[model samples]
Target chain A: MLKKVHCVRLDGDKAELEDEIAEEVPLVIFVNGKHFSTAMISPQMREEFVTGHLFTEGIIDGPVDIESLKVESNTAKVLTRHSTTFLESRKVILSGCGSTSSFLDKKKLPKICSNLMLDRTMVLNAMKAVLRSDNFKRSGGFHSCGLFNESGAIIVVDDIGRHNALDKVIGFGLIRNLDLKDTFIATTGRISSDVALKCARANIPVIASKGAVTTLAVEIAENSGLTTAGFVRGNKMNIYSGGRIN
Target chain B: MLKKVHCVRLDGDKAELEDEIAEEVPLVIFVNGKHFSTAMISPQMREEFVTGHLFTEGIIDGPVDIESLKVESNTAKVLTRHSTTFLESRKVILSGCGSTSSFLDKKKLPKICSNLMLDRTMVLNAMKAVLRSDNFKRSGGFHSCGLFNESGAIIVVDDIGRHNALDKVIGFGLIRNLDLKDTFIATTGRISSDVALKCARANIPVIASKGAVTTLAVEIAENSGLTTAGFVRGNKMNIYSGGRIN
Candidate 1:
């Protein structure tokens, strides 16, 4: 999603120009005829983001929990086979990259168990493939995520938020009944604790990125038995946990 | 804040190394002894972030609206003169950079009115000053925000979240009774609509960044009568709204 806008370019002298900017929309999620959460994301991949977000948020166990889901414009209506008790007690307003509700508690997190391993070439290639997103290259404002196995990159998605991109990727895999434990994710955003938590909740084996990682993210990944690789640039990368790279 | 962690660096061969990652902590806000919201932020500048956040969220008009504020370990206790009715009706779980509650509505936003002007050198210097944060330079995971006037940078703060950094900067100005309308902000993160709304609400005249801008952000900036400069590089930048740069 790119939007053209008129702007003034300033160099040694001012020059008028038109530039492309990434579009962000507010997607409100309604669960069982009630408001659940709102996420700011790119216009593409709305359904995938909703499914992945619900699963990662622990609102749903899997895709089967969702009876029906419809996304019209900026609103997503989801009918799930669960009570609304979880929604009543846990209404939190999370600003920025912070989610300080039940998910932040380490004891409540799910432990990832998998035997997935990747070679140096595979890790580097995945990072490259994700970084080569057309939306990011065009607008320079979108974060990208890619799901990969030993074969190659399977599904790649971009969103205004890095968390949304990863959630969309996971949702795509869940709908297709893919073995998430056998797949890894490559992202173009920093591996914060929340990002690491999403990967752990999704049961993804490895989370690789061409960005930096936070201290809490490393601790959570180490505790959850998930591998984290950051700074995956040309010919170099850092493995924070789950030394599953050969 | 940086934490030393043992990690494996993979180039052609894997080598063990010690790396520094940024630290993130959950700061739970309690208004009138009641839980308000929780934010994930860097450990430093808790008080400034709290004050700025309350003002930007429209919970308080200024620093005087707060009777007392105390920040302990990870909890910030704020006693406001206003009733908690606003908190009861508006509880939203914003997953990423989305705040679809009261703040996202453009009609409810405060239009910025200021005569602040900056030269090309001033704009470029502010961007450079903000980007030269030691925390970001060391860990490569912290987002930085700087308050600037025509002379130079005033206050610079770094946080795990960009929104937190800006809020800390605003709080610093508020506590010092600085005229926010006469100053501007420079950040090291993408300019999103929520960020632009924060500046508009705070009456900050200009927002410049070395990162990209979203389409919604540009629209909000234009509507709020604020100036937005993006891609502030060596000798060039793009002006999206309120052409206040000479």
Candidate 2:
């Protein structure tokens, strides 16, 4: 998923040639033979991305909601339960590149009823693990996402887009039938409303990151009963919503 | 149009409450009274966003191509010379959002044949200025985009997305009829192929950032004859393409 490219390194008066970069590719999705969406993503995790994208976009409920998902070179064809009826409508263009869905309804977030409490140490460890991943450590061009329980990070995924990282981990949880109600997510991107809302829709109660948290994200998380935290560096962090951290 | 929100801070055992979070809003754009695109943005620079988005997406040629632009609370209406005919087609979704458009063509970039030699000091200073902007320094939620000539950063824009920031500065340049041949862009987001291609299409020869540059971005910049640089910090930087810097 990562690649190296020749580059010139300039450190003040000294200059050297090196190769250290990540790979990005355009992946177009066709739902039931109809063009749905196009994403510029890291070449890995196509299936997880499709499942997570479909679920979060409200296109399909879960992995089982699809009859078949075939990923060819840079393209994925998903046959969802709603494919035929959904394909009748026009393609809805979403706002940004992380995860764009025309079906996102922020006002109608699914109620998440989880009593999960996040441990600061676990969150810190998860954040650290994302930065320590081979993908990030090697190329530093990917965003990392970690799904954690009470103990620690269960799985970590790195993607070119932070939204896709969250989706991959969440989709992984959904596929494995993990009890997401008892789980939380730690990512390496800013806490935007879109990110927080994704966790809310996925029923993941806690969203932690080592980046800034937007006000809309805090409001949505607070209303939707999701814990939002950011700037999870070293031993300090800011909790924007949900129960106060001890 | 930034807003402040209250948040909780945690540092081990001590906790404090603060209200220092940045605001984010969804802005939907309509071209010729038809739905064009929707974006989650910082709420300012809607006109610039629309103009830049239309131009970058190949919807419009420049500011002159737009007859009028009206921005409501959370929506932007654009009347472009090609809006009527363009609205007849379907909406095309692009990957990752800073102002994503369906009309971007990467393989056919406009040739940039400027004899501009990037000044190491100028790039360094521009990067620092973006980080030092009040929006970034205060909220840290906005990505900064700066357009620089020989004098210095002529215009710097802060947006929730790096792509939007780039569009804003470029849009500003277009509206003011600034000569882009001698200009460059400095940003605070990773150098993706989409980004590098946008600058290449806009005929901006130099793209600098304090973030990682992807492999595709390097290849695209190299092939498009645009200079690319990344990891621009305190006293060191990485120049990926164009000319070797001393």
The candidate maximizing TM-score is: 1
The backbone clash count of each candidate, in order, is: 0, 3
Q: Which candidate has the highest DockQ of all? A: 1
lDDT string, candidate 2, B81-193, tens digits: 75444432233333332221222344455677787886688888888887888888777788988999878889888887888888888888888888888999889999987
In candidate 1 the C-alpha lDDT for residue B191 amounts to 94
Candidate 1 interface RMSD value: 5.1
Task: Rate residue A239 of model 2 by lDDT.
Answer: 81
Q: Residue by residue across A155-183, what tens digits does model 2's lDDT show?
A: 99988889888888888888888989989
Worst 10 residues of 2 chain A by lDDT: A94-103
* Model 1: per-residue Cα lDDT at residue B190: 89
lDDT scores of the candidates, listed in order = 0.85, 0.77
- Candidate 2: give its CA RMSD in angstroms: 4.6
lDDT of 1: 0.85
- Segments in model 2 whose C-alpha atoms lie over 4 Å from true places: A84-107, B84-107, B244-246
Residue A156 of model 2: what lDDT?
91
